[model samples]
Target chain A: MKDETDIQTPDEALEMAKKSRAAAADAGKKPLVYHLALPAIVGCLIASFALRDGLQLAVTAATMALLALVLWRVRKRGVWVGNLRGAVSYLLASLLIVLTLAAMFAIFWLKRTYGLDWPAAAIGAALFPVMVAMSLVWEKLRHRDLTGKMS
Target chain B: MTNPANGLEPLFNAPTRLQITAFLSGVAEAEFAVLRDMAGVSDSVLSKQLSALSDVGLVELRKSKLDGRQRTWAALTRKGRKSFAAHVAALQQLVQMAARAAE
Candidate 1:
């Protein structure tokens, strides 16, 4: 039998990557969706009300396409395919964008039903930046937590 | 590193080197000790593996002072990244062929 000190096959590299991906999760960049979600949501929401009926969806589609392009371009950065869990984490990250959109739509529904003004939209749109701020704050906290022990 | 386009990199066949490259491919950089821990190897073994990687220009190790203590970090170069991708593709191909053969 081959021992642990033996040379790893190419397949072994893949298997090892799949195995250690979770414990090493903190090493890679956060999923791309985390950075793009709020902007995409805010863009669609504003486009819906600010633009004319025909232009509303067109602008939203264009914005989404732009977002997709950007995401594709940056996809290779810090990409690590650890295992099924890592893959699922990325999948869930993208799915969170849909959830964010759903929340924005809920606000749109309120505006249409209750005759709320742009003030409501403004407040709703403001949440997107708030989310960004909170995530940034949390990221800093996590960074400090990670680095503090090391230094 | 061998030309990934040509074939799988035999260089990374060693378990320690494979583990190091695999982990570094995901992150921008990691402390040397972190990588050593990840590879589950001793100082000399990881140092030797890292030297091999560095010799082939697959990885770059840098030393700096952090909090008055010397710190070393390792990162995969662009060539390293391409090689890793190619090797992974080759591995996937082999797996598919094996599955098909078994079926």
Candidate 2:
């Protein structure tokens, strides 16, 4: 029996990882489903109504679909498999959030600067999904850290 | 240090397991191949260590068939991650204590 502190070779490491995966599979008893999907669908529907418009509808739908895709992929392919890709994807998503905020902030600043009042609906349509998506991703990541689940 | 959950030494307390956990703890999840490469141990040896950690509920394992072959992945449980953090804290303390004694 290998005691604790035993040095492992490359092959051993792979075997250990294999065993770890098997152990996790054996332990997990819950029927896997989209844990956040129903709530997300509901939230998206509410936002669609609030920010109803062609462009708003399109953008919001796309963003929600993208989020759903990510969650689905993460579920199908274990978090370990997409670890590097996931980091990159999250980084890109965060950048999108930053862009959304900057754009909204700019709109408000321009309105104040030029004595123009742009419609909140227009801004809301564009900004709402960005903020929602960002918060959703952040919440997922935080939950993973808190619960050790692969979001 | 002893594990409060099971009255055993923490997984990361063992140098080899510590090194393995240290490597896996940072990344989201690690494949058996990646861990094997990083730990620099034989397959059988690594399997034994992982078994010990799994038995203690500090780590988790999942295996699936990919391309009609088996692929294995490992992740730290919440308890395991917390324990790793605690072990690190303990190690830092030990180091500080040793430094003070040397001084």
Candidate 3:
């Protein structure tokens, strides 16, 4: 409640600074669903590989549609902490993409070589946890950036 | 060798304005109601403070309709972010100075 002109001591200034940091952190906070949605969508996309031909294409299309809808809802929330402007963010994104492709290839190889059943589904199930962890890391890094606390 | 106090901007001396800028610094943009809740300020108070920051080129405001309702969003300009960082650094410096003096 005190204005800057009213802050006469170090304690007052520190309090204001703390409040500012809290405000910044709060601005970046999102609903729990927001965090889980992306990983689930990616999981569906990966799982689609278990289907054949027409069904696979249909699943992929539906997954894309779901991804688009999630993105739209996030945008409508009026806050965007994931701006993807920094080098570290871009690096993380690229790494995820590469890892996803590698996982998909591994699934395909297993399916063709060993006659593994539901290889894509198995890989997708495994990937869900990894993607969730990465999503959490992404949120933490972005929040740090917003608070000017990134090291 | 520069004085940290010199980095502090007069506009952000107001706690409310500093809070607004700090919140905006963390995101691409925020809805007016979200900012109001975070800052714990009324709509009019928030509008006033936002206008002050906007007038000084520290913040940008946009009005749009979402779902058939009017809404306003606020974002910090590049200059605003620079200024806020400086203000925060200055505050930290003050706290450190006090701590050292106490020790």
Contacts from the true interface found in each model, as a fraction, amount to 0.31, 0.18, 0.50
* Model 1 Cα RMSD, 1 decimal: 12.6
**Cα lDDT tens digits for candidate 2, A55-147:** 658857776886777555554443342232247457856686576566556655755687444433355455545555655564455334433
Best by lDDT: 3
Candidate 1 interface CA RMSD, Å? 9.2
Query: What is the C-alpha lDDT profile of model 2 across B1-103, one tens digit per residue?
Result: 5433342244554555865665566556666766676666778877877888888888788886655678777777778877766655544455455567789
Query: Candidate 2 vs. truth: CA RMSD?
Result: 11.6
A1-151: candidate 3 lDDT, tens digit per residue: 4333455454565465566666666656767786788888888788888888799899889889988888778767777565574688788889899989998889889889997748788788888888888788877777666556521
Chain A only TM-scores, each candidate in turn: 0.48, 0.32, 0.73
* Per-residue error (Å), model 1, residue A1: 16
Candidate 1 vs 2: which has more lDDT? 1
Best by DockQ: 3
The two-chain DockQ for each candidate, comma-separated, is: 0.14, 0.12, 0.46
TM-score of 3: 0.76
Q: What overall lDDT, based on C-alpha atoms, would model 2 receive against the true structure?
A: 0.55
What is the descending lDDT order? 3, 1, 2
Interface RMSD of 2: 10.6
| Alpha-carbon lDDT of model 3 | 0.77
